[model samples]
Target: MSSAQQEEEVLGKAYDGRLMGRLLAYVRPYRWQVVVATLAAGLHSVTQVVGPYLNKVIIDRYLFPTHAPGSHSLIGNYLPADPWRGIASVALLYITMLVIGFALDFLQTWSMQWVGQHSMYDLRRDLFHHLQRLQISFFDRNPVGRMVTRVTNDVEMINDMISSALVAFFDDSFVLLLIIVVMFRFNWKLSLITLAVLPFMILATRAFRRAVRDSYRRIRVAVARINVFLQEHVTGMSVVQAFNREQRAYDEFDQINRVHLRAWTDAVFAYALYYPAIEFLSTLAIALILWFGGLRVLNHT
Candidate 1:
């Protein structure tokens, strides 16, 4: 493998606190935006939880009207007894929740994106300034394309981590925590049954992460190779043409591109398998809930 490919293939620690601290330095300037975004994400998670609860309210009070003793005291007391009015009221509340969720989602996305772009701009400017001050030996050792990729593609990955991945982590954690609380509050037994599949889900997630990591490494190496090949050949295209090496160059490029294509194919395949596995696990959890909850309902226990 070429030096660029080798560099790309070199694995780093999964989580580097020092590196994260460095990245956080960029975010420190816009800490207030991050705070707003995090709050919005948390509220958005609440909106998600509320939707399902509203569905339950619609079923129990308005549509089905169980009228079970002590059950009609909570949400029912606030709602109109007339079915049509109650349904309309709940529908209005749901729409309002949807609107609030939309606004929160937009605010969170915009704020994070704004922070990411500004942070990356500062990062790239620093990188450019550093590059300008580098010694001549540094330029001789590193391929121009590799250096360009560091400034462009690698920095974009950091931006994605900031804007998308970190945000997702926070948002999903909030959703998960809220869902767990709601689930246990509603029925502890049913919640336990639903969560019985947690171990399997963890295993599947680990396997999926491993597969994706390998595929990503391959993709990075392939991309680095392509960049290096293109930089060298394109810059020396006149000499290649003079030497009648067009066919050879084309074949080499074709091979490099095929590696890139195969890497992407592997990544896609991993994702395809992962989503279905997660779906299966989710279905299993739901099935377990239905089976156990159905028994409870039937037994009036």
Candidate 2:
């Protein structure tokens, strides 16, 4: 199987519905916090949208309509019929948005953390519980490192991916979808232009992901080899000195360090190109929006 396919299979085995369902069963008592947190996320997104709309209105109705850039107005049309009243209204609205956004952000951070750490607590408990149930023969055959790897590093990676990447994916995708819908509503032609380079962006993303994965894998291998070399030489230092094998050990260490350097360089090069390409595409979208939106606004059609 392809590495991508293998990775997916591993993730699937790690997070089967039966497994997660059983895990979430422990969170039944905290369901209220989960529900409230989800609602807060929605409100956060809503307020984010509201802030920008308010800015656009202020620009169009007050700034753009009257004072040119760098010119100070005499506090005329920009002021409402009641200046303090209008100022107070804007301030209150902005404060409300800030308060809501902060509250939601805090709730999200807390909820995701509570859910993640709590789930891990239950999972580790179960894994240890299951490990104890295994026969003594299994333990005799498998090295302690193997078992430690499963319970420690593997579990940590899985938890990090689910809590950080999974949550981020959901939040980012929902926000992106909502933004795209709004953009389409504003101007379908511009939206199409904005999305025209999506395939390229996706391809770039996949390439970067592969590059980083390979770099980290190589780094891990190199580190392991170095560790083994160090352990052998340190343990057998007396024999090595008697045989005068210091030069040989130095050469081996140099080779391992070179491998690590090469892997890191490749990773850096991949991201160096990947990020600029993505940024260029994003800039192109802005240019397209301006060129197209300007035409529509000019024709008033």
- Measured by lDDT, the strongest candidate is 1
**In model 1, which runs have C-alpha deviations exceeding 4 angstroms?**
1-4, 67-70
As for candidate 1, its clashing pairs are none
Q: Identify the leading candidate in terms of TM-score.
A: 1
What are the candidates' C-alpha RMSDs?
1.6, 6.6
Model 2 CA deviation exceeding 4 Å by range: 1-34, 65-88, 135-141, 215-269, 297-301
Each model's lDDT: 0.88, 0.69
Which residue pairs does candidate 2 place in steric collision? none
Estimated TM-score per prediction? 0.95, 0.70
Which window of 10 residues has the lowest lDDT sum in candidate 1? 67-76
True lDDT of residue 258, candidate 2: 95
Clashes (N, CA, C under 3 Å) per candidate: 0, 0
